[model samples]
Target: MAQFDEVFDWVVVGSGAGSMASALLMKQAGKSVVILEKAQWVGGTTCKSGGVMWIPANRFMNPGEDSLEQACRYLDAVVPDGPDSPGTSPARRRTYAVEAPKMLDFIVGQGVKMERGSTFWPDYYDELPGGVKTSRTVTALPFDKNELGKDWASKLRQGFLEVPVRLDDGMKLPFMKHSWKIKRIFLKIALKFVAGKLTGKHWVTAGAALQGRMLKAVLDRKAAEIRTGSPVSELIMDGDRSVGVITARDGRPWRVGARLGILINAGGFAMNQAMRDRYMPGTQAKWSNGIETDTGDMHIELAAKGAQLAQMDQMVGFQMSEAPGWDTDYVKPGTQSTTGKPHAIQVDQTGVRYMNEGGSYEEFCENMLVRNRTVPAIPSWAIMDQQYMDEYGVAGKGTAKKNMEKWLASGWMRRAETVEALAALIGVPPAALGGAVARWNGFVRSGRDEDFHRGERAYDNWLGDPFFKNGPNQCMGTIEKAPFYAIPIVPGDVGTYGGVVCDCDSRVLREDGRPIPGLYACGVTTASPMGRVYPGAGASVGPSMTFGWIAARHAAGLGNQFG
Candidate 1:
């Protein structure tokens, strides 16, 4: 007896950072909005992230000497404009440079807690032109779940850590600290958890906190609705204009009409094998860390409806290693190679070192792709001495001896008494491995990596063992210990970078370079604003939320107006 079809002023396809931000902005503009999430939970892969937003000249942080001009200069040096990568367009760049700070201020004004993340977080490539040593990234402040009520708060995504910790607290303290400082920090975190439990004040941090606050705003506004377990299968069109979406719920199709526009923010094609095979070469969809639900349904359906695609061959990547307890089938989502630690060196299949081991995850995967063109660079081996293993642990796991025993017994890692023996076990030539180790040890003695300049950059030093301060080279340490180990690593990606092309206003474009009315996109559904390069921490989420905000205002016919 009830109507199977519904109508709203705006409908968002996904409930990630982009979709949530868009929904909130539209609600603030007095628009009736609804969100469609395929999964039962609200957060996507963003829940697994650090939830930092890289906004240059943001008012939330002390901008110091950073300005729109400096930000543009940095972007120009890193992200080049091209037909395939429209992220570097002057109009889009300027829009992002100016509107990003405003977007941040707007969200923070909506009861979303925030703090400066640049004091300790370094830029990914601070040595580059227009790059600063700090103060461009902001992170979500921890939230108490009691404020949202139990039933409503339960819908939020669970964090990856046992205790609530901010991005800078989680990233900097554990990986870079003295033993005493690390212990003290852990104790402080433990005490906070105890106090919270006693006070019935449950807290969540990182991406969960970020999405939770946005979700709270949506509910607080009371002008929006969220429908989970509703997978949008297609878009409904009136002539050439997108009017709504056709979603599948409870094994039935329902048409949800939008009066203004339908914004598609349902992530990228990272989990679609067919798209992966067609776009990314020498890489498979299984290697992506994106959520399994992110299979490009919106992208495929929209592309069929005449939306133009761009930057399909690029991804935000990392160097990932697998352990026995980990999800080897898909490689763990946050798996990272422990390359910057002392006495550890990454080598190609030929037992030859390819790049600076102390580089960022994006840099690591970029170099791996370049090497894959001519040689078998993926599944590279990370060789480390027992001293390094004992000090910094192996891969991205902890440094406990019990963990080491479990890894060794389960065959998750290969170990030997000497470098030559370890090389033999890992199918690397003994002589080649020996020579690489000798050269690395020589660099350690001189405190200089003439071959690759591993510890030359401040960003590199930030990732290195902070306790090991030997002149300017904290990343270098002699691998002369008795026992050695080798771990197999492969090129892993966080998410695909390619999607439909959009203009500065975030309107999806046709194949002939014209904007399609009433059809907009944000997040990974649109081509990245940073092109193929990641400028700094939270680059993906930052632009995703900003553009999402932009898309809603544009649909409301107030694109030119700002508060």
Candidate 2:
């Protein structure tokens, strides 16, 4: 409601994880920066994620002790040059390959912490180039809610699970906690629910914890501020070198100048149906976990300022619960990120395995399109067994139970005490459904999935619990545990990765492949490094934050040279 103007050294738009990380780091470097967010809240979809930050060769990762090199080998074997990749040109990916450590070091050195998992999880398609079994995945130790300086911790957003306090570096929460009854769950959640009221040893949820910690550092900077409810309508370009942005901060327009560059950390086009129709047609918006503010306005506003778009046809799609009130259906209860493991099998309309059932969200969609004869890709079921659901608590037991009830009540759930009856309702022939289950059961009984090899890799079994049967035991759950239930599975996504083209340094390129001065983009707003592929856990956030820091550093004139 206030109309005023001020100039800063840099302007970062969209205060999501990417923007917040960039702004915090930029301010750490003594650059005067301002972050603008269109949403009423600051964290965006990140606050709702599972909260794991995947970084290879990170502090907790043991290259000599654990062998991250094996994983890198897997990734190189799988990850090709993503199309419209601005920075990952053979040169950029290679450069980024080397710089990743230092870039990581910069954040860690600046106070962002990290903790590597015992083993890294693959990005669904562990069989692909550059894909590895484990080690690059990491999490941050949880922050005490009290450490957030009261006001910061009190009113912040909440994730689905009760996050555990971690010890060590920057990585945060990784999975959802389940198995407890809904009452115990809610009681524990109630304590966290009144997060504002509790004081003792409070732990931060991953996405929010990560962002909040980063925000704490950002707010500490002199002349740096987080401006939410600010949506940039126009670029204040003096010629081509983007000088500032004219934004609407709570319906009041204000001009904030950027001395060096205006960073478009505003995220991607997942929430924008118009942009979805324009580039990634047939893609559903509700599947994405990206910021609600990421509706392509920043892309259009930036393009009007001379930024070219890239990777506009692909998105980071995942199989989400088609449950009501599940806007993006975040699989990570307390965190805003998914572990991205291929625990679920995506079958075609014929109930046949289509593509690699465990492909990354992006790869899943692209493969579906490439294999479009597999009609009904959009509404496909991510088939799983009752045992698997009971063990990991992924999607959480309470949410799943309620969701099952809702589905059963709304007729979304196809329930039959027998697999054959369920197949009839789902239209999958009794023989086919019964046969698939029988084969799957055989895999469970034999402890081997000869056909799909679901748990062949250590990554696929990440969700498996110790109590599960060993050998034929691994994650193989019997579908025979009736009443056999099938909640309608819908395609979900972290967000869309189709937007403006940018180089590795996060500078947007025009159609002519030259940098659009004063304009830089990262996160979903810029082309992703994996393109239509997800390399592993923390895939989108890894590049989004890494490149976001890269872009902010570049805008500050501290990073590498631009061609």
Candidate 3:
């Protein structure tokens, strides 16, 4: 039997960007800290993400140009207009404003290289009121794969690594071409990748980059350490204040004490069936909201000890393909929305358009459920024309044929010559389906989709190869093109957005809305600062990184002292 280690000043759970940042920050604050990550590999879901941190007035980008007041004003436009919302809660919003700069300073000043890769990636609703088009997105300087060294390689998940696969497979060509003019000003990502290899530049992806960057700073300083495959089974409670965690690894069970604080940066339930069924009852998912291991029990366990939970009902559900991860994702890249692609219109159970095809994840989800409340959801179909198949090449070859064949052969998709005939085959009321397409066509012709505003956002217009030079725009083929196609669309999500709420100090909150003693949480375990609107190009990662730094530093008692 392995002997249990005694105690550290702080202990963190989960290895995602937020949790890792916490561990790193705590260590920098001169407190002994240990990170217990459930993943065999480190980076968590962050490694699998696009790695953008939407920090307003961050030190790296528009340094000396941005301020807290400006960030708040920009946020005022989008943060849900209500009490009990992220924007409405002064304390929670303040938490982000105060610590965001510190997090950026600590991580970047420590040598985590960064660049503005998203000159073209606009806000989710850039064209909407109060949306800003530029300056919010940031990316890691291109990283050399060789720079991770051997220790980090096997631990990296392959699923999140697919972007490189597509790049290497010549998909980058289409991304930079006349047909795919999605980006007007390319960050030169492909060139950067090539240069990174040659120049020995090592970079992080999405939130993982932020997490990894922070971890590197602390590890170099030897302030904290992370132990993979160590899962905290229970909290070490000492008279109402949690003291340590009982972690099990390699068949050995033991307790690792936390002298000062224990923060659960573990993620939320996009993967766990119970939490998914409870919080987001209608969402269909196969992978995770963040990670497959992000079971909701961490809160349950803490709650057993009287830790109050907040916003258990809210989750970040985006539109995912019918097949979920990997195989399904091949039909469309993660960055692209389900709308205006080589598919059919997305309708709810009542067979009516519920959202703009180019909307963000949360709005997409909120609207989906709102529509579902009024109707019984049969699968929504993606109606495609044979001309669409031949001309556009069905999701650019290979992927389209494979998934569509599987769907058609499996009866999930049907094809016919007319929109009415195609709708009849799927049982979605031929007239309703016909009218929907006609309305959609009218929107396409006038270059104005009045119903749902298909090409409203700059992001959407860029993705569709619309004939007009109107940025990324979409058009319908009039099913008049014949040999129309349709596939069932079911609403799904990446994960939930709520958990143990915390303040800028990274302190967990009590039932009375007080920061709980010696406890903190980041990642999906806390209230998302985006306040129901995803602003950052990689919105999820920004808060995760910022909060991770906050939680870790505060837990290690370094919140005030760190440089």
Best by lDDT: 1
Candidate 3: residue 529 lDDT (0-100): 62
Instruction: By TM-score, rank the candidates, best first.
Output: 1, 3, 2
Best by TM-score: 1
The lDDT for every candidate, in the order shown, is: 0.79, 0.61, 0.61
The TM-scores, one per candidate, come to 0.94, 0.83, 0.85
- Model 1 local distance difference test score: 0.79
Cα-lDDT of candidate 2: 0.61
Q: After superposition, how far is residue 356 of candidate 1 from its true place, in Å?
A: 2.0
Off by over 4 Å in 2: 1-5, 63-75, 82-87, 117-132, 149-157, 160-202, 249-251, 324-346, 355-359, 365-373, 382-407, 442-447, 478-483, 559-563
lDDT of 3 at 230: 81
Who is ahead in TM-score, 1 or 3?
A: 1
Q: Model 1 clash pairs?
A: none
Over the stretch 1-563, how does candidate 2's per-residue lDDT look in tens digits?
A: 21238888878887666776677667666778877777766666666555566566666665463334544554556556644454345545544455555566766665766656445454466556555555576655555555666776654556543344342211212222423343454455456547644646566656766666666656655425766667878787666677788888656778888877888877777788888878876767766666557688887887776677777877777655555445444442211111222223445556665543433455555766555543665555445555434433333324354356665676655667787787677776677667776776676667677886666655555534333444543344555566565544445567776677777777888878888787887777777666555666777666777777788777777745211
Q: After superposition, how far is residue 480 of candidate 3 from its true place, in Å?
A: 4.2
Query: Can you write out model 3's per-residue Cα lDDT over 399-502, one digit (the tens) per residue?
Result: 44546666567664578888888777877787787788777666656667687776667656544553534223553334447778765555555567777656
Error of 3 at 441 (Å): 1.6
- Candidate 2 residue-wise lDDT at 65: 36
